[model samples]
Target chain A: MTDLSYTSPRSGSRTANILLRWALYIMLGLFALFYLMPLFVMVITSFKSLDEIRTGDLISLPREVTFDAWRTAWSGACTGIQCEGVRPFFWNSVLIAIPAVLISTLIGALNGYVVAQWRFKGANLFFALMLFGCFIPFQVVLLPMARMLGLMGMAGTIPGLIFVHVIYGLGFTTLFFRNYYVSIPSELTKAAKVDGAGFFRIFWSIFLPLSLPIIVVTVIWQFTQIWNDFLFGVSFSQAGTQPVTVALNNIVNSTTGVKAYNVDMAAAIIAALPTLFVYVVAGKYFVRGLTAGSVKG
Target chain B: MTKWLEEHMPKLVLAPSFIVVLIFVYGFIAWTAWVSLTRSRLLPRYEIDGFIQYDRLFASPRWDTAFTNLFVFGFLFIVIAMILGLILAILLDQNIRTEGAIRTIYLYPMALSMIVTGTAWKWILNPGLGLEATVRGWGFEDFTFNWLVDPDMAIYTVVIAAIWQSSGFVMALFLAGLRSVDQEIIKAAQVDGIPTWRVYTAIIIPAMAPIFLSAFIVLSHLAIKSFDLVIALTGGGPGYATDLPATYMYTMAFSRGDIGQAASSAMIMMMVVFTIVVPYLYSELRTKDD
Candidate 1:
């Protein structure tokens, strides 16, 4: 092992470095294409006419662009008895995600505030229990959850779905907020307490404002998760209230008619758009939330 | 009274969520175990029968296929994703000019749901509509890549889709781990005349063993719980060729109207998850305690 630093710097070494750099670039570039290919195919196929799509290769550019598929996918594509396309279901997802994200983030913030700042006798145990929720296979809970929903007479409803998402979502959201809040000095809360601020008062004035970053992480995470969830959306909600993912699945899996490849691709893109939009617009926080929630939590 | 109320407020604020977890997470697990022991169909019944449901579940060929597929899919998915993720991370760790853009491209897939991943891959792999047809149309008349419809090969298609969705996530984790490695250590290795690849192989990677374990734990659990991906991609079709445990449980619970079978399968899935996760949790918690 000759020390490069101790040896005279050589053009050969520099060339080897440059070559290695180029090799890395090329390999990374190829994988980038692999990652982007399905998306490219989805977008291009969505834009192509059915005939053009049939005629063209999977990776070929469409001869003529068309929004017919997008239009049908959004407004008129049939999903079983529903011929109203994915619009209603998309709204259903929006409806479910908003309250679920809000409620879960809020509760998670409070939970984090308590567990991190206002530790009690069983705080660590409670936090541990909540954290365990993050790892349980949702399948394990599905049967009983359905039964619980039925017992409560909230089965197959949007509210029921929201309840389910919020319930399961608390683990991750709480983890995010707790991890974030844990880094904040307890002196802030202690000072507020010294000034006679109660728990809610301190949370409202001190913790909440300081919580903007974690809230963003939690909201983005919860929104993306609840929005993209297919299992609960499919299992807990009926046809009229099914989320976009389930509708998209039904539309794609529909066997009654000829497979509408173009429409299906368009619908897939449409279903993916909200999360993708969040990823593009707030991708930094999205990734931060992901890394924070997983790596640290 | 004020002092008492103040002392109790945190617990009260935390009570609802705590109770929810108590019932939903822990209690439901118990209930599910109980249901597994009962002879229930379509709807649950309370009469406890012995291990009949487990016996039936073990006997069913669908369950066998589902268990086998779970192993195959989980093993391939975790290994491929980790390797791809490690490679991508190492490459990106080279201080490339386009690292951010390339990383975003790689990670954007993770933001999308498995349903979207499955649907896109299903179309891409569709025999008549996707890769095979397109290749044939390009005058590669001998070409055949119809795994989507090929019963024997359909499970691999699911693996491919799962890898696509998750590898980027794993990459992000490893990239973070790579970045957090001490620059001094690398410089020390370089000054010691260690080859660059050898330095990474011997020093940097070994230092990130925790990240590797964390990534493995996350990936394994995800692989175990995969449901939407299989549903959106194969629907466990070509006659139940790609039925992972999650989908198998869903079918038994919902479509097949066998509550006992569903509960037993669900319990088994939970056991699989517990086996993977509880040890990880134990280690994590023990470290935290220390």
Candidate 2:
């Protein structure tokens, strides 16, 4: 072929490749924009004054970028006679979430260790039973759980809600640690056994240290689940012991009044900030934990 | 081991948790199932009702809508989440810059509860407040994004919001699977001058089958019990377009004061979940057995 013709063909293919690349970029950009639109609206609405929210376009720049909504959502919004924002429930949420995380993950790690290392006869059965429990909707068990809590005299308290969180969280947390433990080499546990380490000792010193990755995951997962849990928090407890989700819900989920979009958005975002903060900070380990959890032993 | 246990410690160390789960979780489940079979209403009454509750539940139009909506919501959620997840996964796996930041952005929604995130999305999707107004303000006088208001389209809005919350986890799963792929395979494809897309489509995707299955199972389970998103989004409204089984069960038990029928609805949902979960368990066990 002539040199000029060869160059022409090469340039034509280069142009085609450039066109394809631009098309792909545009498509992906559009998808990302659509994915982010909801978040964009939430952030913008949170910044706008309530009057601006009423009068201006949702996409428009806020005439006044005020922290008033944030302040109100956090401190002044009222669900009932009390005008406290979700402030009280914030402490209640933290109280429930911390213990819920600690106890659940500790037990989960132990359960995972036992199931993965020492397969007792009914161990698989136990795991299977727990796994099945995960599928039962909370609605199915809510009444029974409530009745049981009432019988135990722990109803409508932080401890009662914590118990509910632990019960519901057992499945996922066990699965997380169980799967992670299975990924670990059995030889390590066997070596610990040979060194005269009993179950508790080996777990405390070796298994526990090695399980930082999965533990972080379990903690993060349980923290977020318990922190933001609404059904258990709302149903298991009275108004006084309700978590931030319920408090946030009462602020935004009002049925009889004209809904305040800006306040609602701010409140929702406020409720989510703790979990979102964890995700932003320790999100790396969380992602690692998720991948590790998904991998089959 | 049995003989050793008999000689030393008879009860296992894990017995406490096992019993807790059995009595509280499993035992309560049995109790609830029993309640479904009885004439319970407004509260748990221990009197047998035969199949009366089930019959009534099957006959109710609201129940029918709830069941239909679940199937529609479940199918659409799984499909869209898988597709979008795959696309994001593939993109992230392409040696992209700022991987950590992008990964965080994607997975943050999964960490928050559906009530919180769903409420946010509901506001953003609301016609009067969110997208519709936003589009109209952008020099589009006739812009009509009314899915939030339309009875038929409202559920799709929920699906859209749910997909946003879940597909990130799916992407993370695929990314993990991608990371585990043998580096030699990609090198071999490069040596053979195969295009990157062809290589990913032909070779890597097939190898990521197990991860895909795992993601599908998790997403499907979430879709089935997806009550909070429905509740916070539309409250199953514009006339019950987004009513799911779990939310329906809630309304039946609490709002309508039909505890038996609600329990029956929960039972049916259990059966549906069993159909999905039993096979998943079986396949997982079989794979382990092999």
Candidate 3:
């Protein structure tokens, strides 16, 4: 958020107007604090020792910043079910998310290309069918999907989770690509067709190259959705395959012995880092993805 | 063969995904619907048994609590988030310095998973140590803010965390909408000596009905599907007090071994979603043709 300062001109006497402007800034700042204070608290708390956490206040910066909590959170915190920490689960998430994101984005691009440029009979209807998948509660599919995964011998496996993600993610991915591809003139495709191009040829040579922006949006969208997922992670996954969100929940919510607040906070932050990194760096596209994914066409 | 393959290239390319959606999405939904109608216990029994599971679901007090919690959580979360989002957007719309920075701060939570948000809030509201202790330490002495454990208030804690996560995204939406409002109309209102607040209330806000609806749909859908947040924040506890339908369904099928009740609840959830979304999709598609 750059501060180029294009403050809309307001109508008031000088004293009143300046006061109002100050009040607005204060209010905005307060809200910003409200939004940001948790992340700040999480960071500071993650560094504090359990003694300091027990002794100090929530808003105070740690007296002695330590990485021990992070180490414990990353490698050895007991999550009731296991004591190896969220490291394995985090890797499980990475394993699930990378392939899921890639496959979903690739298929979504193709689906989008077909719907937008290579419209065949009933493509829009099929596209609409796919779009409808976006809104279906995963609960509705849980019973059968579990059964289906079990039948396929992929139940409680990383590939099953990936398959589930890719299947559900197709809607948003396809929507992104189709909407983007539609903005390009069809003449490009037609010209290529006249010059003896096949379906994958024009798509690979033209549409795929032209789809970088939408691809970024879709990848970020898919990555965040897959990485952050807990319902699917918990439902379909067994002991070793759960995602970090599930593992983080287990670590934080575990009722065993003395609660490790610092470790819990560190584990939470560790789970949050990837998505937080994406938001901070590519926030503009993240916002674009939200808007694109939300508005139905 | 080459000619046939060339002619069918587009269809060939699109076939797999089409089949996947057909079976995975549409097919599984039908399967769920079928399962919901059966008397399945620990495992699925495919034989039809009518709406007996629904009778069981509606009869259960836990489901009742979960159903009621959905409305309370959904209403408060959606309403407060939109109100706060609109206000933040309005403030940021003032061309203030640091608008970009404030906007970034506000929207950063959206990128995080609900689970992360839940965990952070869980820590923040950790009964004695987090908010209550911090506030009491400030010499308020009796300033009790233990919503995290109170069964009645646990849902509201979920609402608060939800608002924190989603309201920023709403702010972004409204900010975009505010920025897109016709400049000429605002200028004309200003030229006519209308106050800024009136220009907003009487014109700008009214023109954003579409945005409000979109936000409402998004927020409500999220509310209905809110399982992860509750799972992390309260674990739908203080013992099922924070349970929404999603969690209820999960508990019944996975933990409790009451697959019939789970399937039925899942159907009801889908029905709720369809009622909200079908109309919205209809309106959107109808308008798009023009």
Candidate 4:
């Protein structure tokens, strides 16, 4: 590459600095608009009644701001004889997502702690295998997974779904925790060991408290992943046991019915709200967690 | 015995996950690959029927369209996402006000499921209901922004939506890299009379090469496996103009009940990803370990 270093002859002037400042602002302002456009439309459309939305003027202020669409989307919208909207599935999602995050993160912490701290024989081998498995597309594994679940009599059940999510999440979750743990000085674990703290004991006491950042990251990642998962929920869930994403997908993604753009947008936003909330609130930790060892070996 | 037990307790704890992965994840993947070689449909069968499945997969026009579309979508998505991400990172590095808020705004979309983002983008791009109608209503009836409906342009619509959804993630990754750049080097460059843009292009960009590579890999992986966006947005519509390998494999298995062909297509998709990623992985392992 040519040396791109430029020697400036012009002095830093009062007018030039101000222009540069405003230019930066204008550029970012435009970018923010681009980012916010789809979301703005979704939020507005969610507040509009179906009649107003049919006018198809997406940019105009809704002639009527009715809570009816939100109500119907959440409660009365039709999804296969359960005219009840997103409530049941929402709760199911919570029920499933909470346990999945907790169990998976716990296991992940253990995996990370062991892999980083212990240097056991073939430990890297195990980690590599798990990582390779992660790269295989989930669609390829669907049928055999379903078959295995069926054989185990756990297919379409919460435990089965939980197992699926944990297994799938194991790679990234382990990667996150391992990288985070590696960053912590070994002296902590070593000192705990000198005090005769058992492996799990040191992890629980010495390491766990220091892991709040990664815990938040893991919780956010696993929560969003398990919560918003469509393929797994659709594949493994029966009607009564489905997550909100499935219900939302059925309602919003149905091919043949007169598609309600407003409800569809609302449902989409609703499906994403919990995860989005976590991102906005704890985005710092999330970004930090992802970036810890971003330049991977 | 006690010493041995002490030495092995940690690995023993790791056993459950390893076993779970083997039996459930990898075992299932292997099983699926095996099924691709057999003549099964809608469900797995033990009967081996030669290379018949692979032959059918090769013969299908849908498969060809899907492969081509993936390359087109993948190339556009990766290139555009990288440019947009790098630019956003550079701009954000200019000591902007409300750093935290802007970071949150940019990174927020990655938090949403592709399904939701796809749906929202679909509405925003709809010719009858969205931008076209709104623009024409502002008195330009001659305006032609109907890409969403145009069969030739539908995949590009997907590219637009995908860029909107993912460039923020790339921005976040690049920003992290930019922040880690040594401030002293930048100060030295300024003292030497190097322009700000040149400083970035020459010093910062090369310094951030590893992060860039990692981000490129991550985004490429995402682009290759893109399914939720396609499913939600166009449903690979306008007679398969936007069809991709992942979505094509899905429809083949579920809708068409061609398990053999679906598996073959799935195998090919996996091969494509593995070919790109494995070489990258090998190089990383070899060079980084040293």
- Predicted structure 1: clash tally: 0
**What stretches of model 1 exceed 4 Å from their correct place?**
A1-11
Could you estimate the TM-score for every candidate? 0.97, 0.91, 0.97, 0.94
> Taking the tens digit of each residue's C-alpha lDDT, what string does model 2 give over A72-148?
88888887666688888889999999988998888888888888876668778778887777666677787688789
For model 3, the superposed segments whose C-alpha errors exceed 4 Å read A1-10
Ordering by TM-score: 3, 1, 4, 2
Q: What does DockQ come to for candidate 1?
A: 0.61
lDDT of 3 by residue, B90-175 (tens): 88888786777888999999989888899899989986789889998989998989888899889999999999999999999998
Residue-level lDDT of model 1, residues A1-297, one tens digit each, is 212222323224667766866777789889999999999999999999988877788999988889999999999999997899999999999999999999999999999889999977899999999989999989889989998999999999999999999999999988998888888899988998899888999989988888777888889999998988998988888879999999999999988887789999999999999999999998989989888766774
lDDT score for candidate 4 against the true structure: 0.80
Native interface contacts kept by each candidate, as a fraction: 0.69, 0.46, 0.71, 0.54
Model 2 CAPRI rating: acceptable
lDDT of 2 by residue, B1-290 (tens): 85576323313667877888888877877888999989888878888778888988889888888999998999999998988888887766544445666667677778778887778877777788677887888888898888988988898988888998888888888877787877677667666766666667888889888888888777777887788788788888988877888888888876788889878888888888778778877777668757
Clashing pairs in 1: none
Best-matching candidate per DockQ = 3
- Cα displacement (angstroms), candidate 4, residue B185, comes to 2.6
Whichever of 3 and 4 has more lDDT, that candidate is 3
Residue B240 lDDT (model 2): 80
The number of clashing residue pairs in model 3 is: 1
| Predicted candidate 4 versus true structure: per-residue lDDT over A1-297, tens digit per residue | 112222234337777777877887898988988888889999999888777776647767787787777877888777776778888888888888988899889999899898878767887777777777767778887777777788889888888898789889888788778777877888877888789888878888888888887888888878877887887887788887898877876787666667788777777787888988887778776676555434553
